[model samples]
Target: MADQLIDSEIIQRITKKKKQLDSIRPLSKSALQKLKERFAVEWTYNSNAIEGNTLTLNETRLVIERGLTVKGKSLREHFEATNHKTAIECLEGLARIKEPLTEENVKKMHAIILRSINDTEAGIYRNVRVRILGAVFTPPDPVKISRLISELFKWLNSAKMHPVELAALAHYKLVRIHPFSDGNGRVSRLLMNLILMRCGFPPAVVLNTDRKKYYDRLKKADRGNESPFADLMAQAVERSLDLYLEALEPVKPGEEKELIPLRDAAKGMPYSPDYLSLLARQGKLGAIKISRNWVISKDDLKKYVEKKKSKS
Candidate 1:
């Protein structure tokens, strides 16, 4: 359980591969714009899924514009409700963590994820031992789950790892522990983004498109070869960062006059602060900035807004 045993070779390989990939795959401004559009659609789709309504990209866009929720009466129904609640809870958890990771914060995050779940010890560390990939990966026994988790948190603190890297590691570790009986995948992904968001990065999306690659890499990591998973995660992080930078590209001054600050625009709107912050951080804040404080021109804001609207 020593940090050295975690294996740094994978980490080194990932670092090298990331550099090579960055050299060959420079993200253009246009590609970033496309990513932003895709992200907005994806966010809505995922959010809708949390609400029990499986949505296509177009449907997700519509749901975002016109609020809709699925009405079901089964586990799926409960999942939808809990999923939406869990998403919001996850965002809130991100807001609570500060600077280096802390044991208290990790426990709080676990609690947020299991808030309404029916687990025997909802929000608490696992008491019974668990296995992964059919192997007795052996987490600390139930009696030791809490202390072990705390130790893990301490290790995370000592690593002083970058938020993106920490998020990736946390995801792998949390899944490996399988602390909860259900909702582990969703919770782990949420925890990953919580760490990323705390580090000022946009949330990383694990697309169904790359699900196989994701699983394969995770399996490799579980077998004590962390490089493949680390590299895969790094690619996801790079993709997210590229899209983020693209969204933030400055607009031509004086292009659009009617653009208002998102908070001001959302004064009576139902959008959450987390959502608004994402917009601002990603450079989609034209609609959120006050008109008087508009840094970019009216025409530019108009153009950007129109482009975004058109895609929606």
Candidate 2:
């Protein structure tokens, strides 16, 4: 089916990069620390913003890094940033040991997400029925939440799909169950990335700018069209992989052709990364593949630009 094909394709791409990453296994401690810190800020900001938290990205960083409260933000907003960072730390620890996803783990993460914001609802399933604003689908009854969640974990354990697909599907499944009174979205995303990181992949961050599209994909999954959502998660994973691989790649000496990812190759150009990728795939821009990732030399990109200008 469509889902199957997407899953296979994404798995192949991830598998290829994972192999290359393994060749550079055991990234330097400082590099790992730097990447984690950056992602913590970005992930915390985006996740909280999608949930309508008022802290700006910079404010979230200041609050988390400096422990200094924002002038106009509520106490809850500060707590959200701090708590999410704590949850991310927990996630990093779990990933180090290759921890399996479990209900208790989910609860622990949800608890951190809601700590000081809603203590009563933290880490606990709701006892009352509720409606998600603007959502077309209705969650199951509160009485059925435990059973539904148990079933989801069962599926997660037994499913043989790619990690990207499994992560996306798990996220949608949790969202549909709406097991918690609050923090379901944040918890679901945390759980999704937990699976991805455990599978030796980077965390897939759903940016705040894609909030509308994020919900729209969930809607599609709710309507029995899960492929688009899977594809979206795959792209997110690809971006994270791109980031890690680019940072970890060694700098080559001299004018000798040093191949870099399209993202790096497109720097200083008007073209977006996606556009550069498209051109590469279309053969308009000369690029080579390193384990399914597009890599182009600076000279190649310059030549391509010159060729395009000549055409114009």
Write candidate 1's Cα lDDT for 1-312 as tens digits.
243322243334334424543544445667655654566456435533532345555555544444454344344434433444446445655556677666555555556545555545556666566655434355546676566667767777677665556778888887776666555666677667777666555566665555666777777786788756655565555445534533544444643334344445544444564675565434343322221232323333344456677899
Candidate 1 ranges with C-alpha deviation above 4 Å: 1-67, 71-93, 96-100, 110-120, 133-140, 251-312
Model number with the top TM-score: 2
Give the CA lDDT, 0 to 100, for residue 163 in model 1: 51
Candidate maximizing lDDT: 2
Per-structure clash totals for the candidates: 20, 0
> What is the lDDT for 142 in model 2?
96
For model 2, residues 205-287, the per-residue Cα lDDT tens digits are 88787689788878888889987787777767765775676667565564424668889888899789999998765434545
lDDT at position 278, candidate 2: 82
Error of 2 at 10 (Å): 4.4
CA RMSD per model (angstroms): 14.5, 6.1
Error of 1 at 299 (Å): 25
